[model samples]
Target: MAARRKANRILAAVLVPLTLLTLAGMAMLWPSGSKDGISLANPYSAAPGVTFDTGKIQSVVEESCMQGSTAPGQSPDTGGQPAPAGSDCMFAFTEPDQGGSPVKVVVNPEVAQSHGVKPGDQIRYLNLSNAPGAAASQGSPAYIFVDFVRTLPIVILALLYALVVIAVARWRGLRALLGLVGAYFVLAGFMLPGLVEGKPPLLLALVGSTVIMIGVLYFAHGFSARTSTALLGTMFGLAITALLAAWATDAANLAGVGSHDATTLINTSANISISGVILCGLIISGLGVLNDVTITQSSAVWELYELAPGTSARKLFTSAMRIGRDHIASTVYTIAFAYAGAALPILIIVMLYDRPLGDTLTSAELSEEVIRTLVGSIGLVLAIPVTTLIAVLVVKATGVRTAGQSAVGVPDEDRRPHGTSGAGAINADDVDDTGALAAAAFERRSRQSTEGSADPATTRRGRRADRG
Candidate 1:
């Protein structure tokens, strides 16, 4: 307990200063004009652009056909022909422009007037779009599209998930949060930048993933043998996945299926390689499953060891293999289902085309998904055995005693019993004698009890003599 507390204290002391220093360095590195030298528009630029606030919309004017136009066969626009000139059938508001203060903006007032608002009435703007060249100013309201309503439920769900994680996992959840932040930094500060700089995608992925795995697993699970074993197993699995992905990419003649997005990225940045980016995608796709399987296997092995510490390595390995088998079954299905869910629309489109199933399966896009799912599943499946084996070997080699041994020590005589031995005083015969002696003592007590009992014949003879 004392050691744990001291370790915590040490970590706190080191981490606090390190965190402060890191933040200070980041602050120093940031452009003076913008926070972190990052612009929402041009994220990769050295100098960030100035920020401006645009005024919000005061009200919105929505126009629709009157009840008279509700006939099913009627055209949707039968009753409305835009807002009439000079009519109070428009909404108006104010907005700010770039490098300028807020100015009045006039929207169609038809909907507002219909809702009982007049020229001098004040109304809140629910949705507004900021025009280009907006200026930063106080009391400026922002506008959003009416579709923003859809985000409410999503936000609520996110909050609920966060609450559940915190409530259930507690400190581990906090560590996970920290790990998430660390991951963002790694991706933004290291991985993305390195990839954009034209580094080998596979190499970058390996290094970045390694860093993330170490940071996240250690932070969440703490420094322990199980965590280390899991990390080792995960790395092994990742290596296999990487190698297979590389081989498949070459053998299958994958051209990355580049879309407009990739083209746009290429047009914007001269330093990035499209093919490398695709490879990076493949590597990253499998990383999560690798971590999950390895960690799960490691945990299972440790728990099994705890349950039966005296069990031989072969037995432990067999027991862990059973767990690995179950994990492999579920995890393979999980990967396939996950991809299916993501590509359901594509699958539906393919089915609608009435294409041959074999042809559709062999298509480049579908093939990519198949390769990703299979490669990741393979990694997950392989991680379990590797982790279990490592864990068994480690636990056996470490020779850590079980909890049962703490209360009682082996009997001294049994520890070195008399036997026919040359070097060691104890031998197998002494153990045999101990067992034999215990059995013989039990048999002797039984015989004596039977002999000491009064004889029925003697009692009968005594009765006969008395009668005479």
Candidate 2:
């Protein structure tokens, strides 16, 4: 026990420093860009053409007309010629298409002249339509449209998430953080890269998810029976979710849903598969529920064991299952509400269409969300039973009892020697009998010993000793 404790201390000392160093490294290597920005390697690199229906023309116009103007500023001409006054002022029109016609954009003469544009000068269009081109474009437009606005939130959210996790869970949170980092690396560095390189998307997602589960559960909870049970439950749940997602996606015949963005990707990268991307989404979506269910089930089992050490495996399972039942009920609602919250606008639009309720519910887009929620909920529900069963078996098989054997029903009498009565078990007569017998025996032995003594001095010394 002492040795094990010493080893644990040593391991903790080593791990603490290593973990700090790793976090420091992550801080140093963290991306400094914004979240909404485009990337050079993004598959959606092609520019999309703008098409407007008459019904949506007003919205298009409103979107395009929102612009800000800058005041004119004077600068020295490149040719050392006298520049016109107010030539540096600029006006921006937001509408790409004006009045149902392809709009002709003209930079103001004063602004153009100040920027060295002659009459009939054609300004090159910097296409910020997709990620790759947007990434290539440098300066204020790129910063405003892509980096500062687009990508900043992702970075900030990531940092905040890390801090919140660490604050809430402490050491386990740190381990979970490491596991999350590992999962991201596996997904982005391995799974994504492999899929981009033409690997199967479904296979990629499955393997990546498995790797993530193993790393996360073991690292955060350690390689114990409880962790193993949770991992098993989570993996099973993930598999169920993946299978269901695949079937639902095929049945619904879901085409790529990203509007112009998806079209841009299709045009830019023939190697990229939309089907694979869809599968990846399914795997990612189910992971949180899987983790939640497994962890909850494992906790329930252990808590049951702590509460009743000598509890039979069956009783423990029953007790734990009560908790699992509650978890399932709440989690099902949670999954539904979460997806519903995200798709509320879509649902509202469908409702406004005044189609039959059945037809609206069966719509492809709505059905996709429904399938996701149901499949994930089913996976979570199944995970509870698997985790509970595993935990019960593990606790029972290990025969490890918590402190205080009293709770486990080990009686005090069984712990004591036979014929040894407790304080309350002894009577006054028994004590008096024992005392009198001991005194009589001692007195007889003393008289015999004194009579057998040959010398008067010895007898006298014995008597004096006895008196004393």
Candidate 3:
């Protein structure tokens, strides 16, 4: 009991001040909570309000859209090379908010194929003011050409994912889901806005993710020595991940602006550093899985000690490492396969390239993926052992025992490795742990109990002869 309190005091002493400092730092560096940086608009372009929101296609007509064109039953084309502008294309759409109210719009055949639209399709409209004297009023509604509506599908998927997780994991899963929400809050609230404001993306990622680590692990796993040990290990792994990401990014000459989206972002926001942002993403991308590994290792160590309370620290460490090694192996494969699956399209393109394999694989796109995988793998692999070590030490230090019990001392006879030669080969100090001594005492007790029982050979015969 006393030892457990001492451990608690030590952990509190370390974590309390750390938490206060973290809060202070976060308050100082938190973003303005404004989204202006990311919501960039071209000042010369059309107003945002003029654009149409999402709507559903109501009806379609095959009649001519041009002036002085006949109805659909009459002949609209002669040669059939290409249909005229006002020929065979009209669509009616109704906004979701305003049901049963349909708006008609002409579709240009030239650009008609570019944006395919049919009846019952969910789409976004471009409110063009083509009608004569047509204003932005209901009587003269703007032309509602179709784009796409992606909102509903994504929302449905998110809800489904949440249901499955909570259903399977129950309470623990509920906490994990909440932790995920908190993590997303950190990313969207801090990391993203920080990047938009031209803050060092790598630094922002490290700080924001570390803060998230503290929250997510403790919140999902609970606040205790076990969770604290996991949190420490995760933080250490994140630091390693950041360092390795930086080193690998520069080493591989990763421009981080390889994709079209990145190029567009850079052109629009010249202040942003694409490479730095990519490196930041790289470091944080490993955080979720790294947290998983560290936490599992921590829990494993504690649970192992709980099951075998009399085991020495050395035995506990070895058993925990065995689990860690398996986890590391499986996790490494998981990382590799996951990255490969995401990059499969790029891999196909690279495979099609006629250049040598080395040349094709060293391209900017492939190199970024390579660097992300390798650096993340290294950090994850190291985190397992590091986390295990910390957890084992922690549980041993913090665990409570009954009177005359030991956390690091197993039975004296149980200390030797299996199949070891006679006792002469083993030293007394080596086999002198509480575990061994306990086992020896237990054996003595069992022998005494057997001897104290009435002798089966004498009881019946002695009684019969004496009575005769």
Better of 1 and 2 by TM-score: 1
Considering every candidate listed, which one attains the maximal TM-score?
3
Positional deviation of 357 in candidate 2, in angstroms? 2.7
RMSD of each: 14.6, 18.4, 7.9
Task: Return the TM-score for each candidate structure.
Answer: 0.60, 0.57, 0.73
Q: What is the TM-score (0 to 1) of candidate 3?
A: 0.73
lDDT of 1 by residue, 1-468 (tens): 333343345444544464455455444333223133222355322223333233444443433312111222333342346535443323233333333433333332344344433333333333223334333422232332121113557789978987888899999987887897898887777678777666667777766776777788889888766777787788788788888888877776665553556666666566667777767777788777788888888888766654434446776687678778888998898889989999897788778889898888778657778878877887778778988998777666555344433101222232232331245643222322323333433443454465447597985785598578
lDDT value for candidate 1? 0.60
**Clashes per candidate (backbone, < 3 Å):** 21, 12, 11
Rank the models by TM-score, top first: 3, 1, 2
Sort the candidates on lDDT, descending order.
Answer: 3, 1, 2
Top lDDT hit: 3
Candidate 2 lDDT by residue in tens digits, 48-125:
642221111111111111121111132222355543454333332222222342222323444444543232322333
lDDT string for model 3 (164-201, tens) is: 98899878788989998988998888888777777776
Q: What is the C-alpha local distance difference test score of candidate 3?
A: 0.70
Worst lDDT run of 10 residues, candidate 3, spans: 64-73
